[model samples]
Target: MTAVDFEGFVERLATVAGEAVMPFFRTMIGVEDKGGLGKFDPVTAADRAGESAMRQLIKSTFPGHGIVGEEFGSENESAEYVWVLDPIDGTRGFITGLPTWGTLIGLLKGGVPVYGTMSQPFTKERFFGDGGSARCRGPHGERKLRTRACARLEDATLSSTSPRLFSGGDLVAFEALEDRTRHTRFGGDCYAYCMLAAGQIDLVVEVGLKPYDIVALIPVIEGAGGVITDWEGGPAAAGGRVIAAGDRRIHAAAMDLLRSAGA
Candidate 1:
């Protein structure tokens, strides 16, 4: 099936995943430490439940398609068409009862991202895109997504999940970039990227993200006429030390600073 043919399926995946997760939101769901000792990576029952529901539906509806999920490992991952899922892209925010978290559903064809959706069920919002175009539907009503122009670093508003996620050379690089931006706000996980796509934010710099963490965001950003790439200006699908900007000029400027800091 073509990418367009899968759009309906993608929405269904988001719906069921949301159903599985919403019940746990703001409830006393148990949180487990997936990160050992020095770190605090957390996983909750909701994360597992949402992923499981999506996985089951995908397996049943499109038996040949592959799936790579955060809560569960890959299955038939080398197939021609694959689904990448981060059931709750912001587990930290979810645990804190924050609505900033969302479910990320991305589709890859021949190993390249073709379509993606970020669904915030709590707020009844969905942002989706193919590489060429993007749109959002929410309480504000449905509208096309477009990144705002801010060609210079000094005029850009930047965001990251947390500065704490960066350390050593990465931290240094991020801080240098932060200093140049008009404003830097922390704590938005997947929501930050969607906001960037919606023209509300200008730049987003993040490090140490997995495929599931970023794959769903690629189409949304690119479709909105923004640019997303790695520290050295390579494709960001692999997701290490990534930077995205509403304007290419800002993207280039950010890359220069990151490279200078030896990121």
Candidate 2:
């Protein structure tokens, strides 16, 4: 029922997420497929361990806060505060030794994202954002972040989890999307939104996602002067479809393709 002191919580959770995921990033680990439509979707010990670390921190630091994590189910739902977490956002990429994966942490007040941080241990990229400002932390220290001014889709670069992650009717819109953007690349999880927030990518589109998957990215994108919503221009929380673009024009263009696919 009350707003969280995001500045304090974001820093605490970012540290926990970064620490929990670091050891796993350095060591080799086995992977397993948690049932998706196909057999290739992967899950690793890091996913479970990292999320468990975050859950423990939330419970200890804010006992009244609710938590919704990818590896674990919801906890303390009656609480007014919600922490949405994806301990490892790109598990498929993570298992493959790809450094695009990152940890996502979002603090939501009554279902609205108000604070978030996406931290990539392998790449040493950290992004944290709240109502007032957003920034990235690296070897050079923190710097204010901003989305690009790319107003047209043709002038924009596109990125996503993977084009192959889409199937059937979903493939139609994805193909059309590539045709519109100046360039397209695969492999970015919550990090894609971080890139958008940092003005690195123009647009990020994903066909299927859960609330945990997109919630954390909302504040980071919006705080950095970008727009993120479902393809229909509705709330991203209500729908699995997510379109994050540096500018409104690029978002609209990507949405056009998504709409055409009936997404």
TM-score of each: 0.98, 0.92
Top candidate on lDDT is: 1
Q: Which ten residues in a row have the lowest lDDT in candidate 1?
A: 254-263
lDDT per residue (tens digit) for residues 1-263 in model 2: 33354667666776787787777774678888887776476788888888998899888888989999888889886577889989898887777678888888888777778877888877777887774578889877889989989977888999988887787877888888888789987887877788889999999888779878888778788889999898789888643767888898878877886778655
Give me the runs in candidate 2 sitting further than 4 Å from their true place: 1-4, 261-263
Predicted structure 2: lDDT: 0.82
lDDT of 1 by residue, 1-263 (tens): 77679889999999999999999999888999989977999999999999999999999999999999999989999999999999999999999999999999999888999999999999999999898999999998999999998989999999999999999988898899998889999999999999999999999999999999999999999999999998888888878879988899999999999889754
Steric clash pairs (candidate 1) = none
Each model's lDDT:
0.93, 0.82
TM-score of model 2 vs. true structure: 0.92
Error of 1 at 218 (Å): 0.4
Alpha-carbon runs more than 4 Å astray in model 1: none
Worst ten in a row by lDDT for model 2: 1-10
